[model samples]
Target: MTVPPPPWRRAPSPRKRAEKPLLSPELVVRTALDILAAEGIRAVSMRRVAQQLETGPASLYAYVSNKEELDELMLDAVLGEIPCPEPDPEHWDEQVKEQVRRQVRAMMTYPGIAKVAWNTPIPVTPNALRQGEAMLAFLRAGGLDRKQAAFAGDALSMYAKAFAYEASGWTFGEYDPAHMAERERRMADYVQSLPAGAFPNLARIGQFFNAGTSADRMEFALETFVAGLRAVVRA
Candidate 1:
């Protein structure tokens, strides 16, 4: 005899089955960023992201045209995290510096974004535009003409992004203490082993190759950049 209908079929149960979350642009970019944070940018493939979201890769194509689109979306999404402050005419330079710091801090949150920033043009997304505009406003408020402001803004932004990229060290896999020690050893050896006569300068300071803490270097860089930009302003 046929068994009574299974429970699920017997009464389409009062509770409806839980529906799976549908894929969206936000989810795809977010998932990709999470992967980029844990792994390198190369590790964030559509298939991999799809797997993370428990869906098929085809579903992501509807949101992102391809991996390039996905990368741009990821960049824009991260850029949105950087807070854009009001430009104070009285202390525009300081505000600009603060913006650079905020940018570097934000980029550092995602492990490999610094490298991505180098090749990818600045995204013209909503938040990214706001950030750029605020920076330009600061430069203009600090007595820079349109051209000077544009040039200085671009330079400051590039400097911040490049600094963050170098700091990340993800490209060289230096997160491990052992790897870093090996790198420092090789660097010191090569620098010290160089022919002293030909390379007097590097040889003399070779012992100080890995000298300062990262914070020290970053502070020096920020101060020097602002100083140089001020030179252009005064000139």
Candidate 2:
């Protein structure tokens, strides 16, 4: 029979492992956002987040339902950064423009997040709902009736999402001034080269193709949309 080691010669006991913090929805969202910021949205997934959290993927399900729900939560979190101002009756149009600008800016912070906003059919998340309500208030202050305000709000949301998505495509890394200039020059040349008889308007107006910056175009669009609303106001 083998003899046991003496007390002092005995091997040291295993130390108790440190406990991990409990999982929560907020933590999961934050982790996902972190992943999104580091590597574009495509890098974020339930399994990826769970790996980061040092837990099983099933553990994340208890907090976030699925990747789609996670995306919705992320979009809501981005929108929450935009401040909702009190509807100013006199400056309602300006307020609308400012809010839309803020929304675009917020979405631009994380690459590809704007596409989520664009694809989401009906976002019932808290921040998304708040943004919609605030937009309606602004539209109403501009003298739009209930139905008018509702339709305008929907249109404005679509515009903002589309704008953000497009801007992000250029903003993320593809924005090159010299390249854009060369491309525009080529486009203008191609348009002008077309037979005037076949494309009269395009050949004639092609000279104005590169006249304005994106910012200028956005401002003009906003002005046109807000000004057009006055015509639709209750008679």
Candidate 3:
């Protein structure tokens, strides 16, 4: 017995191909961070990261379970950049303020980075927990009660993140081009132009409102916070 061939059988056509690079957790994270830096959080997604890596989002799942996990890792990566200094009770207020300065400086290095961290439960990640421990240790050394030490630590860390988040708003290029100086000028002008009788208080001190550079403003705030903590803890 012999098989017969169909009269109109056609050969299959080739389909489009996609680049498939070897995937790894670090590579995936690094690519996602690159997107975060080049674009912004809004532009990041599993698919977007995969596309950058010449693969599919499904591949990313092997590393980060979801976007939430990715966000955590991203935050941890940033926190890892900060160094935890030794706790010194002798000058606890000064030591704590120095740590605040370092943390704030670190947060400011990456645009929109604080958004991933602010208000999130104290991170259980290694570097983040180390920060928490260091903050609490210094505060306790300053003679504060356990409750006070915890509150002080949270307050300082949150304030730094909040400050960085707000600053990032104006520095994100296309979103808002007005730097702090431009904003200062605008506010001063607006206040000066206001009808004098209605805003007498604002009119008098309007010129002094936004007088300093970013670093100067941060220093002023950090000093005030540290001073307040010193008074509160009676250290």
Model 1, poorest ten-residue lDDT window? 206-215
Q: RMSD of each candidate?
A: 4.3, 5.8, 8.6
In angstroms, give how far residue 199 of model 2 lies from its true place. Answer: 3.3
Can you write out model 1's per-residue Cα lDDT over 1-235, one digit (the tens) per residue?
A: 8788777676655887678677889989999999988887778899999999989999889999998888778878888998877778888878888888889988888867877777676677777788889899888888889998888889888888888887776443646668778987797788778777877776676444352666667778777877887888789
Error of 3 at 232 (Å): 2.8
Model 1, TM vs. native: 0.83
Winner by TM-score between candidate 2 and candidate 1: 1
Error of 3 at 50 (Å): 1.3
What candidate 1 gets wrong by more than 4 Å, as runs, is: 1-18, 171-180, 194-198, 204-212
Candidate 3, residues 131-223, lDDT tens digits: the string is 889889899998889999888888998888887777665555624444656886887789888787888886787545442566677788888
User: Please, what's the RMSD in Å of model 1?
Assistant: 4.3
Model 3 gets an lDDT of 0.79
State which candidate has the highest lDDT: 2
Model 2, runs deviating above 4 Å? 1-21, 171-189, 200-212
Task: Give lDDT per model, in order.
Answer: 0.81, 0.84, 0.79
State the lDDT of candidate 2 residue by residue for 1-235, as single tens digits: 9998997896978998998879999889889988887777778899999999999999899999999999999998888888999999999989988888888788878777988887798999999999999999999998999999998888888888887777766643545677887988898888777777888777777544443566776778778888788678736
Q: Tell me the TM-score of each prediction against the true structure.
A: 0.83, 0.79, 0.78
**Candidate 2 minimal-lDDT segment of 10 residues:** 206-215
